[model samples]
Target: MPTLAINNFNIFCATLGGFITLFGLVSYLFKEKYYLSEALISLIAGLIFSPHATNWIRPQEYALNDIEILDTITLYFTRLVLGVQLVLAGVQLPSKYLKKEWKSLSFLIGPGMTTMWIVTSLLVFALVPHISFLHALAVGACVTPTDPVLSNSIVKGKFADKNIPKELQKIIIAESGTNDGLGYPFLFLPLYLIQHIGHQGQGSDNSTRVAMGLWFGEMWAYTILLSIVYGAAVGWVAKKLLHWAEERKYVDRESFLVFAITLALFIVGTVGMIGSDDVLACFIAGNTFTWDDWFRLETMDDSFQPTIDMLLNVSVFIWFGAVAPWWLFAHSPVIPIWRLIVLGILVLLLRRLPIIFALHKKIHQIEEARQAVFVGFFGPIGVSAIFYLYVSHEFLNGITVDGEIREDAAYLKEVMEVVIWFLVICSVIVHGLCIPMAKLGFFIPRTLTTALDSLGRTGSDSSDDPQPAFQQAQAGESETTDAEDRLRRRPGWSRTGGDSLPTRVFRIGRSLMRSGTSSADANRAPGQAPLPVSSVPTIIDSGDGDGEGDASAKVDGKSDGSEVSTGGGGAAPSAPALGEDVISGRTIRFHDEQQQQRTEEAKVGQKV
Candidate 1:
């Protein structure tokens, strides 16, 4: 076959691979249970067959050479696709949304990083003993950053409960977004030390300190701070440009200019100047530019957002499939069978357990706890992991002159490749499988429980009376009446005009309701109120006779009177009968007297 035909064939394979993977993912979106599995299968199959297909079409001598032609082709496609997808991801993120959900994001960081560190440490100590502590730290750093692409794909939005705090969702998304790039420094620093630490000595120490300082200070902190500032500045400028364009009726021209300028500044300028990992700069720039005004522009369509995202997704995944080192599966010496198994188990446990423990106190529900666990465990090592290996190998290879450091370089390269490859493969499989299972396990139950609880609460609160009225026949001693009155006067039931009688009835009936309800429900009954007997009203028919009776009648007649009158009335008011208003439908009551008592009690409680 001709070379042109072979190249065309390889391109065709790439396109086909892209199509299959995307189709499966799209199908998964539509609730197809097997879609993810099918997608994974298709992905694996394409990875295996696409190269052979390309080879058959164009049998070149150097096709499978050191750097596979197939790999290079895929990598370029991946970068192109990822770039577009990343932009869309940025566009979709509204600044207001992030700000509102900042708390959840903050809460997640501690647990997430802790999990990464602990697991990485344990794994390095246990499995790869030959590797230094620094190397383990490097591995921890590499794996620490969550892969937004993988996490976003696996954590199905539809499965999540709507009531689940938005903060939780934002935390998950934001962590995934920022961490991928963050892990790069961690991955690079250790490898750098491993290679140069001994030879460079004091000078190396200084350089290392400088690099570390830069890594923490400039690249991490300064870059993030400046990106926000620059992005905001650019956004402000874009807003002004947009206003000018609108005033001049040059809206279309203005929009096009805005996009072009933003694309150049964010994607091209930042990456070109600072290096490829400057994704945060691009994100902040896009974020700042799209702030409130640009979104208001009539000509600026949101349709472009999804299209860009899809293109990026296709590119990133295809490249991932294409360039994946099949040789690592067959022959990386650094990651032997024991190491692979140990690392895999350690990574999963370390990544998840700490998050579970950390979040358990804050998240009350069991399902949320389970979700925290699942999300924690399934953090698949992704693009950053591979990127780390690539840079490390390149650096190490550059250092080796002749055979002097070749062994060490080769060993480091092998270790990086094997470990990364294992993670990638395991993530694709484990997370892919767990995604569906997690949906079935945690998300579904949590959603169902929330729905049921909400319905029950709504039903209880919407009833007539909202608290039960005591029966007239049940009127007894004043103490009994006082107890019942106290129950009625409890703060559990609000006396707003909007409240229905049935709701009150339900509140009161709860105490008399049959046993077998949960203890929590029983404790919530309105009858648990504590009020003085003197604060309760005693109901008397006109025939009940005695000076106390007249006084009680007068007290009952008073609109705001809640306490029993105790002046020198006949028979000392006869100790006020209990259940005085048991069945009196005309009676409406509140805790006016009890409230004063409660204030005093509260003050006492506070002092105590």
Candidate 2:
């Protein structure tokens, strides 16, 4: 067997490396400040250096002028990228997150995904002339699943950490990762419809029922169900083996770092060879592999997987940009340029936003209108769409002879590829620029305010009141809502520096407790000066106070350098601190003194 020449290998590597090196210096600013993404950057590079522009890198020519070779490359390339990214998503999610957020995930992957498929099909049918409804459905199915690759741009960066809620980010990650594989059913349904009825002249209603049954058995049962079982089993076995090995000092850190990527590709290959849902299996396997949290914790701080994931993403986008059918956009005999633009715009706008927005109240993760809008708008059509495009092509290619599609299926193939690719390009651009555009007020759904208090500002009405401004703190029972509790309970939660919600509230409560004036000070005249900081009594309320503000101490007196009566209860041991994120009621005497001094100065100024 002969292989293609590596004539442009050095050029390709040098070009890509140079582009990556330049982008690396400013990537932080792009992600953290400007809100741009590698997808957009690499895409622009592909376009600028593509055959259509500089003709610097031509993949089509490399395939020896055979489009099937290029299409095959694309199909497997996307499969690998999607598989690895899905597994990474599975690993990074908090433990038992799927079980906890099952309700919201069901709504998103079920109704949310179906709505996108149907609406997109309708748009394709309406915009493109001479296209059958079934063919249009094929195109819609291609774009139905959100691209996990593109979504990482918005959901996993510093911009997201500061501006987006963690729950919302997790929802997007889970939804995108799961639905990409689930889209097989949607894509194959239309293809089966076209194949059984339109292509072969099996016009009977009974045959349609049979085709549906085949889809259920093959696509759903074999592909989905079996893939999940297989993936979970593999993950469990791998996890146990790794644990057993590490306990005996057999496994090293390097092997652990590569485990996720290795598992992802292994599942993708073995599962694909068995004709099951490879991408879904990859995610399921990853989730189960990290279910016990040992592997994730051990490798939590390693940048190996993330760095590799970035490299995969950058390469694919660049390849996609280079191989994109620019000629078809202007020269397609079936669909006009104006119609394609309209389809792209409409698909991007209507694909997921309205359906998700309508069902926001039902999704526990989506608590605010802004969150709903963000989730809805950020479902980008990217690598997964490209992957499905070729899958549709191969399915339609079955009826072709000598590289020419039969007349009946040729137009379907043309419309599907053209429309799908156009949407992908538009989605990559629109969704990639979403954050920066939102920042500039050119887009809706502006960034959310950071949940953590930045400047130590507590939830208090006025400092001059001098009563215990507890700010909704409760003893024993927590004041945090279910959503907040979920966030606080997430693994790897930081307990210091007011970053996490519970820590901020804890700090606020402790600070207020120490600086609070006594009941005698509260009864002073409106313009009367208050006592100095040294005279104030520090009476700590345990938040189990009656209507008269009476309570006991809960904090361990040994840790805080202060003691209060425990009433009838014994002092409890302090909670064990993880790493440096210890949550303690340690006294900041200088801070308390400065706060009291400011209060006294305020009262003195009021007296004058």
Candidate 3:
């Protein structure tokens, strides 16, 4: 074998791997403290080490700077991430959730998405010079769908589990997953028209009519109908086969965890060959796969999906940062920097918020103004936008020669890419910071208290506990009580507070450090202490629940596969079945068989 040359490729791999490792180490801290998203972190990393900056990792150079190669890489890479995320979303959702929320979901993806497209197109038409409404619609379609990868950051974390209502979280995730696929029709319609219209008035009205016919006959029939059918078929089959294998004890923990992703990739590949919507197929397949809820319940607790999702999402965004067309933003005069900035702001503000806010009352999922605002404000233009941008570019390339656009259609490819990139950047930063800012909002009262205390104008203190009133109520208190307490403790409602600014900040920092330590303890192997069953995490508690017997029996399920009771009684108390525990209102299944296998292996090692 020839000796491997140590070039930028190896350096890039090493650097990328190292950065991923570093991020992985601090990811929890970043999420807990700063509320930063992984996409935002990875993008910044890629930017810092990219060719345009330090030149430490030249991904574009690795592709030899060929536009076709870069686009191909981006397209496939994004395809994999979006497909995986959509399926993951589909699988994790409560069974019958879509059916139950059909009306609300339909409204979001239908009327809501249309409004976004229209507003975005209007913005693009007004801001960018010499762009037609059709091309602007195409660009608008690219950024209309909320990115699943970015939305996951908002919906699935510890903060969301506490702050966002479960229904609202599900709605956000469902909308992002469904609309990404639905956005395809919006994009292809405009693209088909542009292709038919051709360069500088070369096409006639008859060809335009043909394009309209093709849009329905070809794109709709093939991309939508076939995709949905094929997806449902694949999902049902996979679910059946997996269930069969599991019943036979042929499927282990690894296979159980890996199966969904493999199925998602299979859907993506097969759907791509048929020229159907792979992302939509993956979503549909996932829904069909877990329609009965068996698979989802079985694998709910011990999932590898989030880890896989994070890795793929981080990789795609990093690649995006490296290969972004910074030059296009800088040098393109027709779509100048000022226009791009204005368009980004207008698109962000007007795209989905107005529509969603206006229709919040009609939408059954949205309960209140705050929830509606939260949902409306977080429709981030991220990975999905990048994926569609390249799709539009490739389609335009087929129509135009050598990646060149006609004089009249300046909005087709070049200007579209610029606008999409700026929006993605804006979205990544803005949406990523949203939760952090909300967290900051929660601390504003305390900050004021600190200011007053430091100035020695502090009033009489009430409670010695450092925990906020809202936090105390979250510890199994009634919702009404929690709401009342929060209102009473709201800024200017009371002066009964604690230490000065510096001391309060220091104590909060120390509390976080201790919480991390306790979390590690909570996750320790069975005999120590049982994890808490309440909505609030065990780590946040002052200490573990007061007994050892309760801890061991709850964690280590009975050897005979019987339910373990909580209290000794004439009639045994109702308890979760073997290998399952209810935590935070969800059934968390443990791998009892896997644990037994490891125990036996340990015994064998001891005997040897």
Candidate 4:
């Protein structure tokens, strides 16, 4: 081929690589079930077709140096993409939304920090024989925080139970939002100790105190405080500028691009100059900026989310795939394959068990409790692991003596890099595939019921009473009844009781309708006739007096096929017939059955 033709072909190949990456994301949007597998396949194809890997096709002995350029390019690109994501995240934070959900925020912080500490500490102890305790600690801290970007894609609103407390969802989002930044100090602490510990020789005791003080007291504490303060300051200023631009009708689209880039660079420079964690500072700044009223960033968020998502998908899955050191599994000083498996299993279990136990007490219900545990179990190590490994390599490089690095330093770098890559790739695949599939069978019916009950209680306290026994029975018997018949029948009353019945029945009927039942289903059951009772209506009035009836009276009223009887006195009513309350038990059971049927139908359809 002519030289000009060859250059054009190479450029075309590069373009094709980019197209493959974009295609992976597009495929995910249309058919999420095949997302991971398709991304992985496309990434492999892109790598094979890329000009950068042409040397590998010639059967020459492979060397790391040959691929170094590609790796470095991808690494820097990932950082740039991550930086932009952090800035966008900061600029879009609904601080008011988070503030109102402080309980959820608190829940996230408590569990996340605790899990990080516990998992890291345990891993340090478990991996002590193979690796230094301090090194293990560093790795543990690095891997502890769940990647918010990854989790956000998986555990979003659609995947999560609708009846779950909004606060809990907020907690998940905010924790994922903030914890990666928060975990940086932990990532640095052990590495700092490993580096400076030997230099403190004869005065080791004093040196130890100083290092500890700096790591925990100054480095951790000061960095966090400063990031928050500086981030908030920047955010406050950005908010004002946004408002001014809006009022002047000068808030051009390009302005956002300029603002994000400038803010990111400024935060990175300032944080680096001050010896603080730049990533954390950037995240804090982004969060702060997003908290404002005038920015109305939700609009920007909607527009930018897909682009950010695309960038992240490419940066994480394909770019990383193209540069991954696939040869490292055959190399030395890394733990043997069997040992890695044992360690991986231990890490997953150790991380999951603690979180499960912690959340069980706070959240009631067995299935929801199980799901919480499952989420904890699958907290895969991601970009944070790479960040830590990079930091370790830099630290090791800085401590070289006589212009020569220590022999172990090279091994350490390789091990850290390979291990992080292994973990990240594995996590993306495992969690990515599992999250979608797991949603199928992970129903928490009791938790959902409790949530609905709580919402009903808090949203309107006046309607707090349980369904009456007579109404419960009528609803049960009327399941086969026509839609109109069910609607016309007053709640807690059989259809025979005409419109002349008291207003309480109408109120109960309304509550049932609002409780996610169609007006059709709310009517009396087919072939079920209204009960004839002189005493029952009077009893219902007495029991429901002042709208604070006995618990049994309310339960009976709500149950299927139950009946209520009032004595002569104005006291509470007696329990209705057993069948009256039976329907109450059936409502939830029926809903669950319907859901299961739908799920099965979907599966069958997919198969076909």
Ranking the candidates on TM-score from highest down gives 3, 2, 4, 1
By the TM-score metric, which is better: model 2 or model 3? 3
Q: What is the lDDT of residue 139 in candidate 2?
A: 87
**Clash total of candidate 3:** 0
Candidate 1 to truth, TM: 0.59
Tens digits of per-residue lDDT for model 3, 307-369? 898888788888878888777787886687887888778777888888999989988778888
Using TM-score as the measure, the top candidate is 3
The alpha-carbon lDDT assigned to residue 390 of candidate 1 equals 58
The digit string of per-residue lDDT tens for model 1 on 400-508 reads 6444555545565566667766776677777667656755787687677656754554456435544233432122311123344455577664444323453445434
Per-residue lDDT for 1-608 in model 2, tens only?
99866567766877789888888878766765678888988888998878989877789877888999999988999999998999998888888777888898999988999999999999999999987888888889999999989989878766776678888888888898889889899999987777666554533233677778879988889988998899999989988988888889997878878988999989989998988889889888888888877777877777798899899989999898899988999999889999999988888889899999999999988898988888888899999999888988887878554566666677888887788889999998988887787678842322222233311233544444232212333333313333444555668655232344555455444445543435335444458897653344433333222112222221222123233333335432332211112225633333223333334333432222
Stretches of candidate 1 exceeding 4 Å from the true structure: 1-42, 52-83, 97-103, 154-157, 160-167, 199-232, 235-269, 293-303, 360-367, 401-407, 438-608
Please report the TM-score between candidate 2 and the true structure.
0.72
Clashes of each: 34, 0, 0, 36
> Which sections of candidate 4 miss by over 4 Å?
5-75, 97-107, 124-129, 155-166, 199-206, 216-218, 254-262, 269-275, 296-301, 360-368, 407-411, 439-608
The top-ranked prediction according to lDDT is: 2
The per-residue C-alpha lDDT of model 3 at residue 46 equals 83
Across 397-462, the per-residue lDDT of candidate 4 in tens digits comes to 665546765544555566567666666666666666765455443546545755675455445533
- Residue 176, model 2, lDDT: 88
Q: Which ten residues in a row have the lowest lDDT in candidate 3?
A: 540-549
Candidate 2 — number of clashing residue pairs?
0
The better candidate by lDDT, 2 or 3, is 2
Error of 4 at 75 (Å): 5.2
TM-score of each: 0.59, 0.72, 0.76, 0.62
